[model samples]
Target chain A: MRRIMTGPNVVLWLFMIVALLTGCRGGAPLTSWPGLTVAEGIVYVAAGAKVYALEADTGNQKWEFPGEEKKGPFYATPGVEEGLVFVGSNDNNLYALDAVTGNQRWSFATQKPIIAGPAVAGDTVYVASADSKVYALEAATGVGRWEFTTGNWIWATPLVADDKVYVGSMDHKMYCLDAESGQERWEFEAGGGIAATPTLAGDLLYFGAYDGKVYALDAASGQKKWEFQSGGWVWSQPLVVGDTVYVGSMDKMVYALDATSGQKKWEFATEGAVLAGPAFADDLLYVASEDKQLYAVDAATGQKRWWFTAQTSIFAPPALADGVVYTCSQDGRVYALNAGNGNQRWVFPRTEQ
Target chain B: MSQVWNLLLQGMVNSLLFLYDVLAHNFALSIAVFTVLVRLLTLPFTLPAQRSAKAQQELQPEIEKIRKKYAKDKEKQTQETMKLYKEKGINPAMGCLPMFLQLPIMFAFYQSIVKALANTPLQMVSLGKFASPSLSQLVPLGSHFLWLDLGYPDPLYILPILVVATTWIQQKVATPPSTDSQAASMTQSMQITMPLMFGFITMSLASGLAVYFVISNLVGIAIQYFITGGGGLLPQRGKKGK
Candidate 1:
């Protein structure tokens, strides 16, 4: 018995050593960043490998999809449309679930992980994947209609506007495709990768790129009208409100630019990288930074009104609705704050005694 | 605990980014440079470990004699072995320092590569905190290098095979031979199994990590060759020919 146990013990020791060496390779819990979506009094959040629906008023759990046997983490915000919740999972599946009941309606599998939320049209849902393909799927049946392959991964959310689909790719190109057929209309190449969704205001399109520049393009022709360069990569989606475009950069600065000429109107500096897009409500802009502070600044003047400190880094954009703002921190806690004063109203997954 | 880990991770990321910048933004070249740099930095500990291993190998015959003399009494065998080791100025514990030091660095490099080649918005956001102002502009670093996407697994299986081959060669060259037949066989089995296991792991992880492993193993083999005067695992022309 002693002789038999010796060999096995050596093997077990080796196994433990190997395990220690490779243990860090395991998947980390997805950062509860910006995967919060609020619609019709329900706040939908994706965290801990599941999609959760919480009562917006009370921070109570309403329902959770995929209660058990979760395939992967959710990094994209859930797109709620017509009683259906659409979300992309790192499992490489785009799932459409019933919003109220938490039942899986349908799921379409992609070749690679889906990191961007689906853009819902009337009957079609468009999503981009790390497989370097943009897929248009049937909203109800989960059947793929068409897929357009790019030169590299597509990490930006698809924007469906003016009967077309616009998406940015890590290939440093912005593609305008026919929404119905996935046919390419035009492509505009940027100096660096585009990882942020492009925002459309009137006839112009505004977006930021890893090239450290914010671009204003003519929506119809994919022509660059003007570009404003920043000190760092612009990963935050540009928010346009009445001739001013507010965008944040990893340089720890937020710039408000003129919508037409790309002229910098004003810029606000933070202590750390600004990862979240500015949330505007009641003429106040809410911006979260990795500095662990959520700053409420004057949208027009770029002057800070107030700032609230969180327990950890805030990477997700604050969602503003009904005089309340919702944001998530890297510490896995969600905060509901008064939009006007930046005071915490309540926290999700309430602490235990 | 997590805060310390985060800081370590950030340090590794910053080191890699700095190398990337210095190497003209070539990701693969940067990894090669970083591997060489790490090997050079750990030379002090590795050299002592190699010397100790050589001393242990040289004393293998004496150790075997002691084992056979006290085979019936296990406690006496252990005491005699310890006495022999101490008399010969051999510290078995010193031989493990190099490996122990490398374990954390290997894990940290894996994490740094994963974060540097982030493919999603959430990953990019998480990476934002560790990125310096200049390096942040390189977010979503280009993964293309020859036939591999650094961020994804190697599709051609080339990296996994190379990693296994290099790791096997390095282990064979670095591990000293034992006098006991059973111990020799066990070491031989581990020499084969460890590489295969790591090959399987490399097949699933990002190809950049596999690249790092290949380079690191190659450097280890070269270091072993220099320390052992090209004696380990090398073809002995005179003895073998006779």
Candidate 2:
């Protein structure tokens, strides 16, 4: 029996040893791609389970909401309006906090996680959730006004324009609903899922879709004005300035299209996929790429002005205010750069130590 | 090391996505098909290991006689064992090679599945690195498979139980019979402990991985049964009376 057991015993021991070694390689905590929003001299950023209010110029912590464990990570950027900061969490709750004090005013719970930031319009807040519903809540209270269910999960933030709420869903359709009654205005079917929030310019609503197309539709009637095919999925919200609409694509290129005709004007190529939407300042478009670099491009010519290499990939869109472009990277460092020349103003979590 | 592993895992991810695309984008069917494809791909290495194990089992009686003959002369016993191994054209370590080769593939599969079923924004962004543009179109793949959320643990504990049962059966079939009573008892303990440990682990991890484990074990058992001609670690019922 000893002789017979020797081989199998050795195999078992080897299995155990391998199992132990592999088991020790546990997964790291999930890092959330929480975007930054600057409002009224304060920068609101969500990291881990806390929402931090930092002094926009100095990067010093003001206060954090909850002041303790919140039990969920925040991924949606905070929307600031009327002295209140609204942010969504993976905890399936949308928190409304005092903008200056970081004190929770109210929280509205949904059936599933809220990954999209809330849009505050008048006295109502419109938010989309992964539960396949777009909820309208009373901004002053945590009471639900009404909810509009979609065919699939809603990842794009709701766009409110002229008493109408425009939103897209993974169900491959974009729905425009009346802001007051949650009544559907019209639904526009796209070739693929709509993950990017729609941008409004004049009467046209512009957005990118997973179908590798940038579409321009009539905001009121949901009629397709024109569409420009891209080489890859367009996952970033399009930014419109003047007559140009600049959008980034997963194909590692940013294209400038005429807002009216959807005609491609010019394109700037990046080293990696452009997942973050472009932010416009001083006739320059600042965009972050998955290649660990942020670039400043001329809005008119699509010419690269300057670029700043980050420590890691930049997945969140850069927030620009007061000539400083603030961007966070996957490596856990937040950088503030000069918007004109792309020089580093300061980096949070100071690397000196 | 992790970079190399990530690159290898990317290839696995692409393969899985290919299967998924072929299977009408059904995530559950893709996993089942991918598991079968992996088993078939490793069959060449496994065949040799199985033959070596069978040879080792067949030579056990002769090996026992040699051990008794050179009971006190350890050096002679070693020399004789080497001679017997040479004559039989059997490499003693051959049985281990297949298991060793499977380690990296198993890890790659685990990483690929976890990343593919990413539920958070950061995870989705990270998954973009490994997924092709075509595959990215299928983001947020439907994880529900017959009441199981592939991204989360199985609350009903059905998959975990199946994992344990299938793993126990596979281990029993693969473990060669032993002659020493203490060794046999040790083997028995292992057969029970290993499955229990795996079941416990499976209960805490994503149910998709547990599905892989159960299917892989079932396939392993089927292969072992064919290779060993129905003889396994379990004793034959009618011969037990003798």
Poorest 10 consecutive residues by lDDT, candidate 2 chain A = A1-10
Highest lDDT: give the candidate number: 2
Least accurate stretch of 10 residues (summed lDDT) in model 1 chain A? A1-10
In model 2, what lDDT does residue A27 have?
27
Question: Against the true structure, what is each candidate's TM-score?
Answer: 0.79, 0.91
lDDT of 1 by residue, B1-242 (tens): 88878888898788888877777777888888887887788687577777876677677788889989999999999899989999987877776666566556555666777788665565676676687655654556666799987877888999999988987787667665555668677767876787888788778777887788888788888887776533336742244657
What pairs collide in candidate 1?
none
> What's chain A's TM-score in each predicted model?
0.91, 0.91
Instruction: Mark the regions of model 1 whose C-alpha exceeds 4 Å error after superposition.
Output: A1-23, A26-34, A69-71, A138-145, A351-353, B1-111, B120-122, B126-165, B179-204, B229-242
Residue A105 of model 1, lDDT score? 94
Local accuracy of candidate 2 as per-residue lDDT tens digits, B19-92: 77778877778888888888888787677778888788788789889989999999999899989999999987
Clashes (N, CA, C under 3 Å) per candidate: 0, 3
Taking the true A–B contacts (Cα pairs closer than 8 Å), what share appears in each candidate?
Answer: 0.15, 0.16
